[model samples]
Target: MDQQRHTQKKLDNGNIHTSPKISTHLDIEVHGAQVYSHKVLEEFQEEVKYSIDTCKIRGFSEAGSLEVTTVRDANRDRNYQVTYCQDTFKATCSCRMLERKGIICRHVIWIYSSNGVKKIPELYVVNRWCKDEIRMKMFDYNGEATEDVDIIDGKQIAMSVMWSEIHKTVAMLMGKLKADVDNFSSVIREFKEKLSLYGSPMNKQQQLKKIFGCSASQDITILPPKQ
Candidate 1:
């Protein structure tokens, strides 16, 4: 019944309407702040400033890895070491800011600024906090790629084909149901009766758990609780 209403609305509109999505890269600082707290953002800014002022790019290795050195205080015995990869846009610091706090540290910020990198890449951004992550193509399902469409472009194509079919089918059904209420009710009732024989459909989460066996609540017996 809900599906019928949803379908009818789209049919009345004549065409499916979709809003354009804003890119995450448009305001990297805003996205970053969403993932990290304001306090962390301030600390990150200060780190970037410190990196620019106090840190120096020690040199680059043969494999395009950069080595950066930073000094927080002259009294400190050891300097911070930052390893950056130009090709992958990945940075790791011995300070473990990225590892522990899941945010870019001062050394990486300095390296990026020194290299004229204007925005943080999506690779370093956490998806749970990003607005654009939902709009992006989903690469994997059940611990593997959907039909092996692992890459972004490939997954986009797969999703486009899927949504197109769904829209077309729903729109067609909606138009039919809107034209004849009695027929629609009769058909839905018959469908429900027939479906009752097979039991109800599994929700998305249940379906995924069945496919991947990753349900946290799955039962396990350990020596029968030492009976």
Candidate 2:
């Protein structure tokens, strides 16, 4: 038993590894390296630099939220509302750049920096925009033709291709489908027909279990649409 324990310990020690420290514009002096991708980090850094130079914290609410004013022109200053839930670390800005682009905006960057926040709050960093997304093998292609030799995972590559095609189809139909109620309902009905035609012969419960290794009854409860 002692020999077995020693062997296990040795194997564990061999597997132990540490990664290098990454410095970002948010906080280079401390533990601010969790931002993942350097491109996103650089953009945040640029915002921090701009905020330091031109942005100012105008006021704060009793709820611990802040108002930051970004000076675009001397005559036109943009006021951004920043709300940071201290308990949840969920931060949001009124600029809506983060909401639409999945990236935190300059206004929020200034607020975090001013508040002595060394590490970016995890809630503000969308995983989709991070460098780690590539590492995760979520999607492969970047909508570019390349001649470079690279080993591609077949599953991820196929999924990426499928999603690209779906996006194109959806974008083309977006305007016309939303033009009227009948158009929208017709499209949905057609999609349902196609799905039903191609769907598996197995019952919904069995199919769900076979595909996802979980029971539909336990994992999913289909509810009627709200009126």
Candidate 3:
């Protein structure tokens, strides 16, 4: 077990040390290094390298809101159509890589690079592949609310954190509890008793506040829709 753990630690350290060297494109290094997770970045870097080496733009055509560029792949001797929208900075490739796997294809990357796009567009950056989304904070170890009280209510954040922590703890122990039927029943009864300890039933407004982490009085700004 110790040797296995040592090997895993060494591999983790190696990935951390070599992650920065994965991206050869300046644009990817600048825009994606901080935003994407390590595995996603590595895949994206591979596409970027493929785009630079084997993909070439044959021709481009402009249609009202879309620009279609034809890219030829030298490796496969195939032509791919890339449609890009200047308004939203959204691009789609005939390869359907982004649609199928949530990773942008070499065809789209080549088109974007040829167009002198310096940064990866926000529309192409999926939330699931982002570093911040993967590392979401679900618990407060210091037993204190976040410092964003002025912008967002601290009580709401605290409630959200607590519920997340509770869910995580229950999930972690569920398999062990299921191994023994009597223990599982006892745990359920204890949970019911603990729940009853919170005296009165919450009103509809209070229940909504607890679940959503926001009151009706909070000024909620709805941003414009993504294209």
Candidate 4:
């Protein structure tokens, strides 16, 4: 149903509409205020370290049921007790800027200009979440490249692809990628055997780098610093 509506919208406007997305998340302060308001126009809900501005202007909340945490008071210089999302988030501050005017308070406005973003450091790797980790092979096969195609509902959907939805469709293409890998595994094994027989000059670290292109980080689990 959602997909149908999205398609219909695109057809009516003859344009692809971008979905609202939140900015990077910031850390929760141990003891301080947090705000998250920017100019309105229904951008994305950004989680940040301090109070913020409201982006919704017209009829935002019936009984002001709109519960977004980005509102702050300016004159009294405090925060608002905005509640949204079924108590997942709550704000309690003694700010007055938000009390009288039903407009976006100074608290929410502060976060807007803070140039702040959410601080979730570890990003979600689509490959990690999908069961297609080794499908890294999909990226390259012995340095050979291939093209990506779109398929939908057992039929090839021409030029219709969802960028992030790649993970969702993995179940369908997993078999094909795996088959190609299985068929090529022997070639990889044969190459390794030849290299071993010929006596390679590279060390273990070098080989690791060749396989996974990243410098290894410290393994705290294996070796804790001497206390």
Candidate 5:
């Protein structure tokens, strides 16, 4: 009986060593990286600003995040912001309104629900690496003819490839810039309309001619509309 008890005690002390380690080196290859975008972050900001219980919004442009605190009452002084992992999407807000019974918050959802990525400062378009589209289209072919050339293949046709690429990139950037300018112009027009309605400032057309030097009511003639 004593020997049986001793054997049991030895087993309890891990003398057999049958237990396994809690951690192990994973064989998985983790291509871990962060991706961020200002556009997405702006969307998050907009969403948070419209959410209930929000008292103030303080965003850091450098860090690419906004801290939104909630007020306990509309006419009170107390405020509380959500606490959650930005990457994990778990949050806690002042009001126990969201799912998880006061664990998740509205601000965090606003950040991600608006289209938040996993990284900071927009890693997808970071400019850290060379543009792949340019590389693929421009450098895809070496231009060296596979067959032997005697310098008499009708001037080699001289594939003007780089010029095409330059033109394309310029066109793309120009289109983007033009769209932004147009949007700005539209916003200005709306503001001018509001001002005119309130009788505080000149009309939209007048304001445009005054500030931008272009008549807001002018006709946009592309080839004069076929005359």
Candidate 6:
């Protein structure tokens, strides 16, 4: 009876109430913080802090557009090779942190800092870790749109795409203006002016409806599964 009661109590509380607290610390702010979830941001910031504090640039060699940098980690007493392309802002580290865990490693962050790159490249920003809701379209074998399209809110999908494009454009421009303080200030000023022209923002309920594609009067209920 005690065991049954304990199990029943756990079921009533659900996962959120039962899960342990996750304590995270943000050391420094980065562009990833805007897009990525809190957990992902925490891990990425740790790498950034590690690169800044413990990693050292041993040397770098150039081959065409590719530059291979040797970064030594004081804590680990290990060397990592980071190959960076100046033309494309593409970087690959021998540690392969991105490949293994979908987080940029300290070695690559050290190289980026040395090269005056302020923004994390969009390529390194994993979509799975991002806070944005990504909707996937399904296609039939005949290349026709599946019934799933009818269920998803087209407006929400369109807004998501438009926001994604705007984000990419802003990220690209920010990277270009990393060293140009005058241009950067002008861009920020222009953006603020443009935003003011949009007038007052939507209320919380209206904003939620737009994002979730649900009417205020819509009923949300869970039904028992079919036997």
Q: Clashing residue pairs in candidate 1, if any? A: none
* Candidate 3 colliding pairs: none
Using TM-score as the measure, what is the rank order of every candidate, best first? 3, 6, 2, 1, 5, 4
Q: What is candidate 3's lDDT per residue for 75-193, written digit by digit as tens?
A: 87999999998787789888999988787888887877766887888877888887656323332333344442235466777888988986876776765755665665687799888
Tens-digit lDDT string for candidate 2 (106-200): 66666667667776666666776554443222221333333222455565588679779867766777657456647756877887788887864
Give a tens-digit lDDT track for model 6, residues 62-135: 99999999889998999989999999999998888889999789888777777788778888888878665353
Model 6 residue 39 lDDT?
59
The parts of candidate 3 lying over 4 Å away from their true place are 1-19, 134-227
Give the C-alpha miss distance for residue 184 in model 4, angstroms. 21
Candidate 2 lDDT: 0.57
Best candidate, lDDT: 3
**Candidate 6 deviates by what RMSD?**
23.9
Regions of candidate 5 where Cα sits further than 4 Å from its true position: 1-49, 52-55, 58-78, 99-105, 113-227
Report how far off residue 91 is in candidate 2 (Å). 2.1
lDDT of each: 0.58, 0.57, 0.75, 0.36, 0.39, 0.73
| Model 4 C-alpha lDDT per residue in residues 1-227, reported as the tens digit of each score | 55965764454342123322344332322101112112221221222212343322221232353344534444335435533322222222235433443223334434333423232112211222211123222223223333332222332242235433544545455657677656566766886788788776667776667668875676656866798
Runs with alpha carbons beyond 4 Å of true place in candidate 1: 1-40, 57-61, 64-77, 128-227
Can you list the residue pairs that collide in candidate 2? none
- Candidate 5 lDDT by residue in tens digits, 77-148: 445565444454444465554443311233444444434433222322333221111212111122444222
Cα shift from native, residue 187, model 5 (Å): 84
Task: Assess candidate 1 and give its lDDT.
Answer: 0.58
**lDDT score of residue 209 within candidate 3:** 76
Native-vs-model 4 lDDT?
0.36
In terms of lDDT, the poorest run of 10 residues in model 6 is: 19-28
lDDT of 1 by residue, 1-227 (tens): 55965764554343224322322332444445544433345555555555555665544554435444443422233467667777777777788877776667766776776666767777777653333233333334444444322254665588779789757766667646456756656776997899889988677887788777887555665545544
